[model samples]
Each structure stands twice: as structure tokens, then as C-alpha cells.
Target: MMHVPPQAADARAKTGIPVLDERLRGGFPRPSTLLLFSDKPTEKRLFGENFAVQGVKAGDTSLYVDFFRAPQLARGELKRFGTIDPSKLVFVDATSSQLLLPSQEKYRISDIGSLTNIREAIVSAIEATAPSRIIVDSMEFLMDRFDKDDVLRLWHELIEAARANRAVICFLFINWTLLEEDLAQIRSMSDFVVEFQSSVRGGIVRNSMRISEMAENGIRTNWIPYAFKDLIGLTVYFPRILVTGPFNAGKSTVVRALAEKAISIDRMGTTVAFDYGNVNITGIEAEIFGTPGQERFEFIFKIFAREVSGVLLVIDATRPEELPRAKQMLDLVGPRIPYVVLANKSDLVGALSTEDIAHRMGLPSDVPVIPTVATESKGVRDALLLLAEMIIGVR
Candidate 1:
């Protein structure tokens, strides 16, 4: 029997997308395989490239293995994001000879006879540069050229080699190009899968991302909306505080008042599942998620509560007896999660005072309870700002 030494713990890296990072816990795990699938060109590939450039900018050596684009063309595309250090960024030219005959400047060319040669070049590059991150900006082209079994063999070999050397590997695959079985196998082997989809709603293009098969402690988020800027990599739109409470507590009205554009997924004038809205304060960027107040739908709480910066607990001011139910809902999320209480419908003739509602709910002295009339948007901004402060630990 042979005794092997223990390997060091994997180092985590940031994706530079704040909201996405929050959902990912920290970032992609080091020495793990990430698959990015998309039907459209440029969208997914650019994301992978930006990730590589972000690694380089963070002082980590990164390798970009291009099987489709020329090295200079890839570099030019990357420059749109930000300035990258030439020395820290290395390119494995796998498509140059495919476009033209072999030349002196060509680093490595991908051909039928020398398919193994490309794998060797990749392994050598990893050993030589010792990069923390490597992006094979795509596996689709290689999969098309080589036999299915051979491609999988090469993929396993190269990925295992990269992992042994403690480098994270990202393989970009086009979902529509590969066979269903091949795609399924690749996804099963991958540590994370990020899928991109674009839809036209009301004549507007909306890009969203869906994440599957994440690493341990991975916080799964809903289809988060994002966009690419010329300089910034990816900017995610984060929702404001999600307002939740007992059944018929005016949660929907609160979101409608607080949000510039809001949608209520209610049933028969009462919320049954969830609500979504967008709030843009002068100095704040927030999205509001309102969970169903019905006790039957409490399971949705865990899903929405994963990355919540703070929570807003809404209570009907007229129904003081329901305060305990609201408190119980907060208790479901556990302590240490920041939350504010809203005494909604205060404009009604016999509504409870903020302090009375808080006292009845047995809330701590530090908790702030604001009186609100959700129908008129009164105190909505104030409540959200207070929740934001609590999330940031300022209040």
C-alpha cells in the first residue's frame, strides 16, 4: 500500500459580478470544471473571456484556449472589457492553421493528425504558465472534429491534468451544436453549469442566466437579469428587500407602493405564491421580492431567503391579533437576519400604532417599525432605506 499526502484546500475566486457572486457564495471554486452553454454566439463566449480577463486583472495567470477565433481577434475582443496585462494573459492559438497554412508566429495549430498535439500543448501551457484559471473557449469545435469517445477521453485527460495542477477549468459549449447525449455527459462531469437565454418581451431583449449543478454550499438564485458593458464584465440587477408577512397583510400593496414597476402574483385579491418589483432610489439600486403570505406556501421562503441582504416583515395595522403570525414567519428565517417591520394600512380608521404593533409582536428594541399606507406609497422608501442600512450594519 502507498500513502498519499493530503492535498491543499481549493482557493476560491471572485467573478467580479456582485449579485452573481452573492448567489455563488464566494465565486467559482478553484480547480473545478465550469460549463457555459448558450445558443447565441458572442454572449456566452464573451462571458468566459471576461472571466479569464478578470482573473488576469486580479493578479492570477490565465490561459485562453481559442479553437475558433484568432489570437489577435480574441485579444481585441477582450480589450473592450478592460486593459489586460499581456504577460499575465497567455493564448493557445488552436485555430490559426485552420484559417491559414502554418506560419512562424503560430504557437499551436489544431489538425486531424495532431489532435493529441493540441492536448499536449494545453498540458504544457498549464505546466509552463502555472495559471490559476484556464478557459477553453470552447469544447464544441473540438468535439465536432474528434470522435465522441476520443473527445471525452481527451477532455477527461486535460481536465484531470489541470485539476492536478490546481487550476480551474472553464469549458464553453454551444448547447445546440452538440448531440443530446454528449451534452448530458459533459454536464454530469462538470462542477457547475451556467446557461444563458435571451427572450424578446414587449419588443425588448432580456438576457437571463440559469445556474445548475453548483458546488457545495452553493446558493442557487432565480433567473437573474444581467447585461454586458464595454468596460465592466457583467452587471447583475439586484432586487430590493422582499416584503413578507401573514395572509392578507397588505404585502402586495407594500411592494406596489415601493416599486416603480411591480407585479403581484396574487389569487382572489390575496397573494398565493410570490411577487416581484423593481425599486430605484436616488442613491440605491434595489429589487423587491414579496413572498406569499399564506402559510401553505412557506416552502418558498427558503428559496427566496438564500441571499437576502435584509427582509421586510409587513403586518396589517388593523389586525393586531395577527402580529404573532408575522413574528412566527420571521422566526422561520432564524435570527441574525436583518429585518424591518411595516405596520401597513395605517391610513385605515382603526390601525395600530408602530410601537404598539412592535410591542405586541415582541420585537427587540433595536428593530424599527414604520407605519405605512401601501396604497399611496407612503413610508415605502423610508422602510426600504432602513432595511438597507440594517443589511449593511449601519442601523
Candidate 2:
């Protein structure tokens, strides 16, 4: 089974995003600064809000300083992130004073013109609450209104305050007009740099985030595609995952094990057309397509192979000779696609070990070869989840 070792509680602050937390070994390091830089603003805020709500759910104080919205409005919008303790989510309202309106939040920015006022308001909130997590949504507003040096000072001050409290702070920013040198400087000050990008393809907007750690031997994860749930927050998402192998490799069995509901087209107990299912796991959802494993049904691969997020290459561990045919099935699916090997029927007497199977198939050392008995549902979920980690570049 796939496993992510747990870290010390004091070492990290959990994001509460299931797949992401698994990869992070809990979450971002405590007493850290994260630069959430994006080309655009709208998409990145989702991640920030999720982080704040997660802190609240984890029983930690969260200080959210908003320069764009009223405290009440921000609080109302945050409800979409699911249930959070009202007392834990404290906000600094920066818009109400500009509109000459009475503020409901404990902290309010009275004068937008004064950089000193904004800095003090935020500093006071941090000092009073001793928050375990902080989010500035966002820095662009001040960056637009103040001098670069003044804004840089405010950024440094907030980081210091968070460090003092052993808190994790994220600064959301859009690259409106900053030079590369300034951007580099900001990145250098941060413990992690999270970059966001969005694109429209076939009329569907796809959002992705990439995280880069600044320490020696720090990790750089691939662009992980994600989507926000109505009230559950951010989740790692994959639209389609394909499963294939040689004849009688239990491709259909593996699909049924991973999916909540499944269907198969078969002839004489042999899948002749295909098997399909929908899988919903903690903070994840995917549609699984299992291709027929016989040479006569090879054309089925082309129909559903194009745009697969990942693949589960299943082979009967007892029949090592069938491994070549299994590789041929993958060849037909195309190349450069992420895949994990399932050594199916591993419980059988003649079954080969995972390492032996990998050597027989000539698979890369990095490719996972997990032992599984799909009919009994053993190691099935782990195989699929490992493939997800591969596709998301977290493993």
C-alpha cells in the first residue's frame, strides 16, 4: 500500500486538503512565509481562503486581513469553505472605512491613504490574536497604492510577526508591474512559493497550483490540477483514469474495487468491450475506464485512451510471461503518460514478487509496482491513489 509518513505536530500546519496534506507530510512548515504569486488574482484567493478555514478547523486562530472586501462580506463568502468556528476566523476590514461605514470586525483599517495605518492595523491583529495562520487577501491593493519600499517594509514586518508567534503566513499577490529583481527578492524571503495559473480549454476553466520550497533539497511539485467544492474546499481532481492489461489480468476487477459503481461489457465471463466506473474518495473524484485486455479488443484502447490522466497497468503475478503483452497494451495507449503497475493475483501460490515483476517488465525504478488481489480488493485503492500522486507530481 502507498504510505506517507507522518511528521511531528509542531513541525507543520495542516492545510486540511486531503491529497495535498498527504503529499506535504501534514502541511506547510510552521513559522514559515509563503508567497502565493499569480498572474491573476481571482483563482489564487480560493487557495488562501481554504488555508484559513483549514486552520480554524484544526482548532487554530486564523487572522484574515482583506483589503478588498468588508469583514461581514468576507465572512459570508468564507461560509462556502464549510463549517468553521466564527470566533477563530478573525478579519481586518479594510474596505468599510474607505466607504465611511461602521465596521463589525474587531480590526478595521480607518485610513487607506496611510501605509502606517494599514501596517499597524495588521500588526495589532497579529499581536492580539496570536494566530497560527494568516492570509493577506491580498498584497496587490497596497502594492498599487504605496511606494515599493514602504510596501516591502510592511511585508517584512508581517513575516516577522508570524515568526514570533510560530505561525504560517501567506501573502497573495498578482504581478501587476513588479520587476524580476523585486519578485526574486520576495521569493527569497518566503519559505515556500506557490504559483497559480488558469486556462480555458473547450470552454472549461482549469486551475492548477505548483509549490516550490526554498530550503536545501527542497521539493518542487508539478502543477497540480484542482477544483473547489461547494462547501468542502479545495480538492485534487482528475477527470479520467484508464486501466488496462493483457487478457485475464483482472482489469475489470480492479475497476470495480476502486469505483463506487461500475459496469462491464463481457462475453463468456471475459470483458470484450470495456468496464467503467466512478470513484469518489476523500477529497477526490474520478471516472475510471477499463479497456478490454484481449488482442481482438485492442481497438477499444484508441476510443478512450486519448486524454487519460493516468493508467493502472495490471498483470497477473502468477503468469510472468503475460507481462510482455501487458507492455504491448501500454504501447497502444501512447507514451509519456503516468502509470502504476498492479501485480494482480499476488495471493496466488505461483505469484511473483513486485520487484521480480518489475524486472520482468523492464519498468523504470521510479514506477510503482504494488502487489494486489483485486478480487479481494487488497491494495486496489493504494494503487489508484499512488497513480494519482504520480499524475499530480507529489510522489
Q: Per-model C-alpha lDDT, please?
A: 0.76, 0.87
Per-model tally of clashing residue pairs? 4, 0
Candidate 2 ranges beyond 4 A from true positions: 1-9, 265-269
Candidate 2, residues 183-297, lDDT tens digits: the string is: 9899999999999998876698888888899988887888877888888888877777999998899999999999879999998999888899988787777789999877877
Predicted structure 1, TM vs. truth: 0.63
**Predicted structure 2: clash tally:** 0
Tell me the RMSD of model 1 versus the true structure: 10.1
Model 2 is weakest, by summed lDDT over 10 consecutive residues, at 1-10
lDDT of candidate model 2 versus the reference: 0.87
Q: Quote each prediction's TM-score.
A: 0.63, 0.92
Model 1: lDDT equals: 0.76
lDDT of 1 by residue, 233-322 (tens): 776544446689988888888888877788877668877778888775533466788998777798887678765657889889999888
